[model samples]
Target: MEPGKLLENSELGLRILAGENGLNRKIRNEDVNRPGLALAGFYRNFAHDRLQVFGQGEFAYLLDCGGEVEGRIKDEFFSYEYPALVFTHGNQPPSCFIKKSNETDTPLLQTTLSTHDFILNFNRIITRALAPQTSIHGVLIEVFGLGVLLLGPSGIGKSETALELIERGHRLVADDMVHIRHMGKGELIGESDPMIEHHMELRGIGIVNIKDLFGVGAIRKKVQVDLVVFLEDWKEDKEYDRLGIDEQTMEILDVSIPSITLPLRPGRNIPILVETASMNHRSRRMGFHAARSLSERIHSRISQQITEDAERENPPKKERKKASPKPLMGPV
Candidate 1:
C-alpha cells in the first residue's frame, strides 16, 4: 500500500507529522515493528523495511535517553528505507524524531488511538492490502446469506444460474472474473472486476447490468466466499453425493472453502439447489449439520431396536411350576 492510500483508508486516527515528500513511498510489506531493539542500538535484524510503531514504552525510553544518544538511535534506525513511522495515542514525538524524519525524508504518521487499538485496526488494513489474491472466471452470489462461487468450464450456464439466483432475491457480488483475496484469518474476500462490476454476459443476450435491472439491493460490492459450486454437464454414469454426508472442499489462494459438484441436466432447478446448498452450508457453520444429525438419529434408533429384539427373543421363563401346584392343592 502507498502512504497516501494508508492515510485515506486507515481508521487509526492518523495525521501526518513531516516528510510530505515520502507520502508516495510504498510500504514494502505488511509486517510492523515496535523498534525495541533498534532503539537500543541493535541494527541487526531490525526489520527497517517494515512500518515502525512508537508506543508509550518507546516514547518513555526516548525521553530517558540523552539528546545525542537519541540522535544516534534515530540515525541507525532511519538509515534504511522504511514505509513510515506511526505514533499511537496522539503521542507527540520528541523533537529528535521529527528532525530525523526530515533528515531521512521518511514519512512520519501519528494516530490518536491508543497503542493497542491502533495496532488492532492497522493490522486489519495491512492484512487486506498484502493478502494473497487471484482472479477466477466465475459468478459470486449471496444465497441465504452465504457467499457462493459458481465455477465450471466455459458455457456451463454459470452466468445463467447466477442470473436465476439474482431473480430469486439473492445478491450478486461478481460475475465472469472474481478477484478473490485471502484477507487473513482464513477469509477469502471476493469482488468483481471494476471493469465489469454488476454486469453479466449471457450466451445470446449479450452483457447486461444486474444492478440496472434489479437495483442496488440485488448488488453487492464484495462478499466472503463461503461455498463453491462447480456446474458440470450431466454424466449418466458418474455418481453423485445424494446423501450429502460426503462433504467436499476446494482451495483457492491457499484457503479452503466448502465445495459441491452439481450436474446440469434438463428439467433441473440449479438456482434452488444452490440456495439449498448455501442454507445447508450456513447450518453447518451454525453447528446444525443436517447430515450428521440424521446419521446420529438413525444410529440411535437402530440401537434401541436391537435392544428390544433381544428382550423379545429371550422371554423370561415361569419359575417353580411345582410350587404353584402345591399352593392350589392347599387352597382346595
Candidate 2:
C-alpha cells in the first residue's frame, strides 16, 4: 500500500501535512506504531518499517519538551527509514518534526479520527490491500445470505440462472469474471471487474446492467464465497449423488470451499436448485446435516427390526403349570 492510496480513501480521513515527496513509498507492514518509546530516546525495539503514529500523549510530550530536546528526538526518530507518520485525534506534529520528515523524505499524515478508531480502520484497509488475490470465470451471488459461485463452461446458463435468481430477489455480486482475494483462515472475498460490474450477457441479448434493469437492490459490490456449484450437461450413463451423504469441496487459492456438481437437463430449474443448495450449505454449517440425519434414522430402524426377529425365533421358556393343587380346589 502507498501513502497516496491511503490519502485517496475518504473513510480514513487522512491528509498530507508534509513530506509529499514520499507519497510513493510502500508500506509493507499491515500495522502501525505509536513510537512513544522512541520519542523518549529509547529506540532499541523500535519498529521502523511500520507507519509511526502520534496520538494525544505522544503529541503532548513533544509540546512539553524543550527546543533542544525536541530537536534531538526528531533527529533520532527520522534517522530510521519508517514508511510514514500519522497524527490522530487532529493532533499536529511539532515544526521540527515536520521539517525532519521532509528532509528525510518520510510521509507526514494527519487524521481527525481517534487513535483506536484510526488503528482499527487502518488494519482492515491494509489487510485487504495486501491479501492474496486471483480472478476466475464465474458468477457470484448471495443466496440466502450465503455467497455461491456458479462455475461452468461459457454458455451453460450461468448468467441466465443468475438473472433468474436476481428476479427472485437474490443479489448478484459478479458476472462473467470474479476477482477473488484470499483473506487468511480459509476465507475468500470476491468482487466483479470494475468495467463490467453489475452487467450480464445473455445468449440472445447484449450486455445489460442488472442494477439498471432490476434496481440497485438486485446487486452487491462483493461477497465471501461460501459454496461453489458447477453446472454441466447431463449424461445418460453418468451417476450423480442421490442422497448428498458424501460431502464435496472445491479448492480456490488454497482454501477448501464446500461444493457440489449439478447436471443440467431439460425441465430442471437451475435457479431453484442453486437456492436450495445455498440453504442446505448453511444448514450443514450450523451442524444439521439432513442427509446424514436421514441415513442414521434408517440404520436405527433396521437394527431394531433385526432384534425383534431374533427374539421371536428364540422365545423365552414358558413356566410349567402346577395342575394338582388347582384340580383339588375345583373338585371340593
Candidate 3:
C-alpha cells in the first residue's frame, strides 16, 4: 500500500498533515509501530520499515520533553527512511515536527479515530490489499452458511444449478467468474468480479441481476470458500463417489478445499445435492462424519457375525474328559 492510497480511502479518515511529496512511498509492513522508545533517544532495534504511529503516550512523552530534547528526538526519529508517521485521536504534530517531516520528505498523516480503532481498520485493509489473489471460472454461492464454488464446462448447468439454489433461499456470491484470495493459514476467500457482481447469465434469459430480482438477502459481497462442486455430464463408463468415504479436494492458491463431482442427468436434483453437501461439509467440520460412522458400524457388525459363525462351527469341548480323569483316579 502507498501513502496516497491510504489518503484516498476516506473510510480510514487519514489526511495529509505534511510531506505531500512522499505520498508515493511504499508501505512494506502490514503492521504499524509506536515510536515511544525512538522518541526517547533509544533507536536500537527500531522498526523503521513500518508506519510509525504516535498515539497518546508518545505524544504525551514529546510534550513532557520541551525545547531542545524534543527537537533532537524528532530529528533523530525522522532520520531513518520510514514509510510514514501517523498521529491518532486527532493529535496534530507540532509545527517543528511537520517542518522536520517536510525537510526529510517523509509522509505525515493524521486520523481522528482512536488509536485502537484505527489500528484495527488499518490492519484489516492492509491484510486484504496485500493478500495473494487468483481468478477461477466458476459460480460461487453460500449454502447453509458454507461458501460453495461450482465448476465445470460452460454449458454444464452450473448457472442453472446456482439459480435453483438461489430460489431455495441460498445466497449467490458470484457467477461465471470468481475472484479468489488466499488468506493465510489455509483459507480461501471468494468474491465476484466487480463488473459482474450479483449478476448471472442463464442460457435463454441472458443476464439477470440476482439482488434486484431476489432482494439484497439473496446475494453476498464475498465469502470464505468451504466446498467445491464439479458438474459433469453423465457417462456410462465413469464411476463417481457414492459412499463419500474417500473425500476429495481441489487446490486453489495452495489451499485445499473439500470437493465433489456430480454427474448431470435429466431427473437429478442438483440444487438439493448441493445443499446436502454443504450441510454435510459443515457437519464434518464439527467432527460428525456420516459416511465414516456408517462404515465403522458395518465393519463392527461383520466382525461380530464372523465370531458367531466360528463359535458355531467348532464348539468348546465339553467337561466329558474331566469326568473320565476323575473316574480313573478313583477306580479304573
Candidate 4:
C-alpha cells in the first residue's frame, strides 16, 4: 500500500477529527485506553451502526450486538463531553443526540458528523499520529536471507535504492518507517507502518507508487531483516575496502544487524553491489568464511617455508655410533 493510498483510506478519520460529518456518541466503556491523554472509558460508539444512548440521571450505551453498559462519565467532562461525540469506527453510520442530563446542570451540546466523513478524517489522524514519544525514521530491506537495512542521512537515496532493488526482482519489507517488533530468541520482525507501506518519495518526483510500477510481487508488508546497508557519499580521500575482509553492524531497537557501508559514487551500480553483498552474506552463513580461508592458506604456506629453512640451516645428524655399539655388546 502506498502512503498516499493509506492516507486516502484514512481520510474519513482525518475529516472527523477536523470536525467533519461523522457519528457523535459517548464512550460506553468505563475505561478508555488513552494513558497519556487521560481519557476515560474503553467503549467507543459508532453512529452508523445501531446504537442507542439512554441518558436520564446517568447514561447507558447500547450497541448492535445487544451489548449494553451503564457508566458515569469521566475525563474531560468539560471539553469532550461538552460537544456530543464523534464515532470514527469503520463501516458504521453516523448519528448523535444531546439532551439535559441530571449530572451536568448545564445543558449538553449534541452534535454529529456523517459516517462517511468520520472515516475520511480517521485515517489522517492515524498516519500522522505520534509514535508514543519514541520513534525514528529509516528503511529496512530483507534479501537473500540477509536482513540488510539501508540507512543514511535524509534524502540520501535510501528509498531510491530500495525502489531499484524492487525493480531488480527483490522484495520490499518496509519503507520510510519500519516497525521493529522483538519476537523472542533475539529475533526481530520488520514491518512497515500500516499507513506507509510500498511508498517512496523521490526528490524530483513527488511520490512514486511501488506496487503499481513494479507489480504486486515487488512489495511486501513485513519481513525479518538479516543485514544492514549504510550508504554514504563518495569521498576521494577516504579509504574503502578492495577486499571483503571487514564486516560492519548496525543496531535497531537494541538488536544488532550486520551492516555494510557502501559509497555512493558516480558510475557505481549500487543496486548490483547491494545484491552482491546480500549473496556474499548468505554465503558466509553457510559455513564458508572467505576471509578466514584466505588467512589460513597464507599462514600454512609461511609455516611450510619456515620448516624448510630450519632444515637447510641444521641438517639431521647421522647415526654413525649406533651400529658399532650394538655389534660390540653382542661380542662381549
Compute the lDDT for candidate 4. Answer: 0.55
- lDDT values, one for every candidate: 0.88, 0.92, 0.91, 0.55
Q: Model 4, range 215-298, lDDT digits (tens) per residue? A: 888777767678878888998999887666767667666777777889998898898999998898888878787887898899
Task: TM-score each candidate.
Answer: 0.78, 0.93, 0.93, 0.56
Tens digits of per-residue lDDT for model 2, 40-127? 9998978999999889999999989998888788778778987889999998888887888889888999999999999999999999
lDDT of 3 by residue, 1-332 (tens): 89999988777799998999999999888989998888888899999999988899988887788898977986687789978999999998888789988998889999999999889989988888888999999999999999999999999999999999999999999999999988799888899999999899999889999999999999999999999999999999998889999999998888889999999999999999999999999999999999999999999999999999999999888875554344535655
Please, what are the lDDT tens digits per residue for candidate 1 over residues 185-253?
889999998999999899999999998999999999999999999999999999988888878999898
Off by over 4 Å in 4: 1-135, 241-246, 321-332
Name the better of 1 and 4 by lDDT. Answer: 1
- Sort the candidates on TM-score, descending order: 3, 2, 1, 4
lDDT of 2 at 135: 96
lDDT of 3: 0.91
In candidate 4 the C-alpha lDDT for residue 65 amounts to 17
Better of 1 and 4 by TM-score: 1
Q: Which residue pairs collide in model 2, if any?
A: none
Query: After best superposition, candidate 2 residue 5: deviation in angstroms?
Result: 0.5
